[model samples]
Target: MEQSKTNQFNVLAEKPVGSLLMQYAIPAIVAMAASSVYNIIDGIFIGQGVGAEAIMGLALTGPLMSLTAAFGAMVGVGAATLMSVKLGQKDYGTAQKILGNVVIMNLTLGIVLGLLLLVFINPILRFFGASDVTLPYARNFMSIILVGNVVTHMYLGLNALLRSTNRPQKAMCATIGTVVLNCILAPIFIFVLGWGIRGAATATIMAQMIMLTWQLRLFSNKDELIHLNRSIIKLDVKIVKESLLVGLPQFLINLCACLVAAMMTRSLTTYGGDMAVGAFGICNRFILFIVMVVIGLNQGMQPIAGYNFGARRYDRVLGVLNKALIFGSVITLTGFVIGVFFPTPFVSVFAKDSPQLIKMSAHALSCMVMMFPIVGIQIVSTAFFQSIGYAPKSIFLSLTRQLIFLVPAIFILPHLYADPLEGLWHAAPVADGLASVLAITLLVLQVKKFKKQMQAPVENMHTPL
Candidate 1:
């Protein structure tokens, strides 16, 4: 195990930056892309098998889902970030302890929150923009999902830890495994068994539970550097604080996403009605897939940047950052061109029979991605801060896009426009453009800071030491 750890460090710390990124990023990209496809497929199935309002129901659940992930990310991202740095510093024992704490945290938070959500499901959905037409579908779907929330949290948190511990391939496999299984089972449950929207949610949680079983077996192996152990299973206050501090950025990002989603959904409900919210769902899936690919790039960069930063290898950290930023830009740009030229085809995949749905979704898709390319820089810069343990900056960057820019745009843009929904559609690109500018400013300052640290005296470099 020690020898294995040493080899992992040598590769992460000394390998050619480009080659290492390719090795790490491809699996991660594939995994994130697959996860994105899982969502797109869900929209397709629900739109076709259930109805347009079912899609609206599914869309209304977006905020609640984001809230669920917010809690999971709080522990998962924090522990993974800490583990990356600890591994870079050669503190394997503490890293392992963090692994145990992550499990405890996920399990505890998942079950408690899941039960609470179940109790307050209806009121919550109503507040999240569920209407009379969509409330039943949302209620049925959310009930199943909340009941299995622990499985979802455990699987997702463990996957993040897997990547941090030099097991990106395993993490990739787990995600792809769920994607494939969900693809097969979703149709059967929805169409064959006639389970309606609940079938889609059921397929989702079941897939997560199965993949989680695989992850648990891998973590149970005592040969692994970070594995289940009785000694570290109990939570420590210090570890908990550190994990929450580091993870809070991602948690808040998702929390803010939930807030933004609720606002958008409510706005769509008020102005455009259920069908309009359904259109937003289709556009969101396409945009999310693009964003997920960028997240894949960020995941690829995280451990490399975190590890090298901890080892005082500032050049490698910067190298990884530069490459990730460029790659993220390319991904978003591709989405831009496609969104501009092929909006109809993209929206049609979700609602071929509904012309109004297609028209609204196509408009949303084009307007929402007008400044898409800049978004790559924003996302990568936020991840860069989180990777280097600059939690406050990361949190600020994350919130800037969702709360600082997007939320206000959603509200104000509508009143400024003759057609209120047009403003809502335009809000996304406005947020993207503003957030990208903020990212550039903050990242420029951070790069200068990195350079100074690079030039510092041997003992003065900011490192885990």
Candidate 2:
């Protein structure tokens, strides 16, 4: 076990930046992409099997889902990041403690939030632009999802830990397994059992539970470097503070996303009605597919950057960042080309029978991706700051796209345009373009600081002393 642990550390420290990224990023990218694909598939099933209103209902649930993910990312992303840095510093004890705290925090938050959301589910959905027609489908889907929220939280928290603990492949496999399982069970539940939207939700939670079980078993192995210990399972004050502080940016991003989704849904509901909201939902799923790929790249970059930064390898940290930026740019640009030119085909996949839905979705998708070519830079830069323990910068950057720019654009844009829906569709690209500029500025400043840090030792070596 000791030798195995040493080798893992050595690889992170010694591996070439490009190869290391491929080793790490590919699994994560595969996992994220597969997860997104599953979402697209689930959307297809709901749209075809349930009804168009069901699709709108699913869209209405976006805000709630984002709220759930906000809490999960707070513990999961924060702890995983802290653990990665601890391992780089050779602080195995603290890293293990982080794992334990993650379990406790996820359980506590999941239960409390789940119960609260369940109680207020109807009102919340109504606030998020659910109409009389769409309310039942949204309520049915979210009820089942909220009930199994603890499972979802634990599964996500543990997977983040797996990546930080040198088990990226394992983390990847867990996500892929869940996605595959969901795909298999969704059709059965929705079609055979005739559960409709409720069936899709049931299939999702069941798949997550199965994978969560496997994750727990893996952590139970005492031979692992960061396995669970009953003695350390209790929360530590310092660890909890650090985890939350580190995870706050992600938490805020998701929280703000919840608000933004709600705002967008309400705006769409007002201007274009329920079908407009459904169109946004379809566009969102497709955009998520692309964004998830970028996220996968960031996940791949996280440990590498975090570990090297903790080790004071400024050059390696910067190396990974540059590579990630380049890769991220390419990915988002691809999404841009496809969305701009061939959106009809993709949108048609969801609702072939509904021409209005397809046309609205296609136009919205194109508008949303108008600034995609530079979107990757903003995403990568935010993750870079977070990986290096710059929580303030990370949090600010997270807010730039969602809260600072996007929120205001969503609000003011609609009133400016004669066609309110067109204004809403344009809000995203406007935010994207502004946020990318800010990200580039911050990234340049940070890079210069790292470069100076890198040159410091060389300058000292050349001195008389």
Q: What C-alpha RMSD separates each model from the true structure?
A: 1.2, 2.8
lDDT of 2 by residue, 1-465 (tens): 587866767688899999999899999999999999999999999989988889989999999999999999999999999988888878888988999999999999999999999999999999999999999999999999999999999999999999988889999999999999999999999999999999999999999999999999999998887888798799899999999999999999999999999999998999999999999999999899999999999999999998888888888999999999999999999999999999999999888789999999999999999999999999999988898889999999989889889999999998999998999999999999999999999999989988888878643421000
In the predicted model 2, the residue pairs found to clash are none
* TM per prediction: 0.98, 0.98
Residue 321 of model 2, lDDT score: 97
Worst 10 residues of 2 by lDDT: 456-465
Per-candidate total of colliding backbone pairs: 0, 0
Model 1 lDDT per residue over 1-465, tens place: 578756766688989999899888888999999999999998899989998878888889999999999999899888898888988888888888898899999999999999999999999999988888899999999999999999999999999988988899999999999999999999999999999999999999999999999999999998777789789889888889988998999999999999889989999999998888898888889999999999998888988988998888999999999999999999999999999999998899787888988998898899989998788999999998998899989999998889889988998999999999899999999999999999999999989988998898978886532
lDDT computed for candidate 1: 0.91
RMSD after Cα superposition, model 1 = 1.2
Candidate 1 ranges with C-alpha deviation above 4 Å: none
